[model samples]
Target: AQRHSGAAMAEQGRQRMADDRCNAGGTAEHARPGDPLRQHREEEVGRERGLHGALRLRRRVALLGHLGLQHVLRPPAAPLLGQGPAGARAEVPPHAGRAAGNYPMATMVYFQCVFAAITLILLAGSLLGRMNIRAWMIFVPLWLTFSYTIGAFSLWGGGFLFQWGVMDYSGGYVIHLSSGIAGFTAAYWVGPRSTKDRERFPPNNVLLMLAGAGILWMGWAGFNGGDPYAANLDSSIAVLNTNICAATSLLVWTSLDVIFFKKPSVIGAVQGMITGLVCITPGAGLVQGWAAIVMGILSGSIPWFTMMVVHKRSKLLQRVDDTLGVFHTHAVAGFLGGVTTGLFAEPTLCSMFVPVTNSRGAFYGGSGGMQLLKQVVGALFIVGWNVVVTSIICLV
Candidate 1:
């Protein structure tokens, strides 16, 4: 009877151990102290709280008094007739642009200025999240006046660079490269997003991102077509080529996502589209549609790879923390586009346009070495100037 009792106790002990093991293998696996799903839920809650805080902060900021007292309590203006330019003394006729006036022409010019301002605003991606909204409001006009104006004057305004034969057919150097450098510099000044914000929630408004993508697609009509300052065959070709390239890029990026993650994500498609747009900008009018197709493929693949691979391996990327990967998108993609332009420009196509050209870049026959060197020189100058000026502007 004693032996049987001892055996029974041992059996009970074994059964308890087996039961504990089974419990450990079941939901206990998910009950770890720091499961990723639990952490993700916590992150979502934190993000909601942060957004609520930011909204309240912005509301309070809006209530702060403006400089209305100075304007409202000031001395009255002198008579308009004696104050200044012809408008000060003369009443303009309402029907000024009836075939003998500056009304409609001036309106067109104003619209162009608006386009320029909007483009720079899009470049402000690097400043988001950490930038003081008030400071950005100030920085906008300042950057436009100081940086963008000079670039426009130099490249498109028939300034010294244009006369020196720097061909930016579109805006590889002016828009993408310049903005990339400036964005990086501005980020350095503004610092990074909150650590928790950075790691926890990348973009709270992915839907807004999709809307921005649609705007971007339509906006190329103005971005590239307007460069010709006319509606013409070349403009049509440019617009078509732009879309084709973007579509191809989007498809390629999506395919990449499927290969790796078993899903095709819209965000990846948008990234691919953006890269296609940036790459085609330099050669929009000059390259053939077929060439654009090839360029788009390369742009999508190379930048995607760079962002996923080189950035991961590089100390510089880690240090800069370029919030939206603007460096890879604009700077790297734009630079490559410029180089590709040197390789694919056809003299036949170049001659059809009014823009002066020595020869189609290297691949099209004449002075390949010279064309390659010119492209490099132009891209480097823009990059260097923007980096220096942006740093100074931020400091000031």
Candidate 2:
């Protein structure tokens, strides 16, 4: 009886030791192929070590790239105050006001490059799903040099429109209008996507698209806020107006969708958001908050009408096959913004934001009417130039 008892105790001890080993090895007898607890612990360890290391590496690489770009650009020093030829408060030198080793100039250059990049991305909307990669590579440089540079110079670089007091606070005409017209023209030349794509070019991932759109929306704060070239009251107003207009336009658009289509669409709301942002851009700092809401309403409704109603009716619009409706969202909204800027730009705000002295909207009752005329003329010039240049580029 004592020997049997001792044998039982030995067997029990062996079984407990085996169980301990299995647990420590993370391969318990009952463990499945993918043990949840073990897998989770492993993932946590990886995140702590691997993710932190990767993030550090990414930040270092970005910093190195930025330094290289700064070195290559060799931006000039900031202009000195009262250093003009005649001793008047000198115009800020194009590369003026370096806070640290020409950082100001580098920053300005970076901003301009980003603006140009955005323009290219907008133009790409037309060429998506088609266009030879080689041609696109060549086309970018040519378009920037000839088409984009000319617009930038003419409007913002003290060219004809700048001298004439036509205000584009943040590239309503230069970026949005230029890209829209250019995209439409390019689409005509490149031809449509395959019929299958056209018949059903559904977004592969709606959530991802929404995420992209959210980034774009938030980025507009920098887009408009930085135009003042300083962090001032105007910049603050511009950023606020941007959000207000975008939100209002989104709500208006969604409501319209629910009424007409019997359901709200995330895509439609995004489109409305874009239109509102575009519409307010030209006068972001130059218009009052109330004007922004009014502009939002117009932007949301007019673009919606054009995209949904006029697009179907107009043969030219139908033939172009602009995949993303850049024409309606950008061209129409931008034109509307320019016109409204001419009409609603407050005198005080204009004085603060516009380069031209005493600039005021038509509603302010001075040379305001002329401003409107100039705005229209400027739009026509951009449209004609983009159409001609884009066509030439495609043909070449």
Strongest candidate by lDDT: 2
lDDT of 1 by residue, 95-181 (tens): 221122234677668855865665565467776667777877877787777777777677767776655555566787788878877
Please identify model 1 stretches exceeding 4 Å from their true place: 1-104, 352-354
Model 2's TM-score against the true structure: 0.74
Which portions of model 2 show Cα errors greater than 4 Å?
1-103
Q: What is the TM-score of each candidate against the true structure?
A: 0.69, 0.74
* lDDT string, candidate 2, 234-317, tens digits: 777789999998988998998999999999999999999999999999989889899899999999899999999999999998
| Pairs that clash in candidate 2 | 78-96, 78-97, 79-96
The C-alpha local distance difference test score for the whole of candidate 2 amounts to 0.84
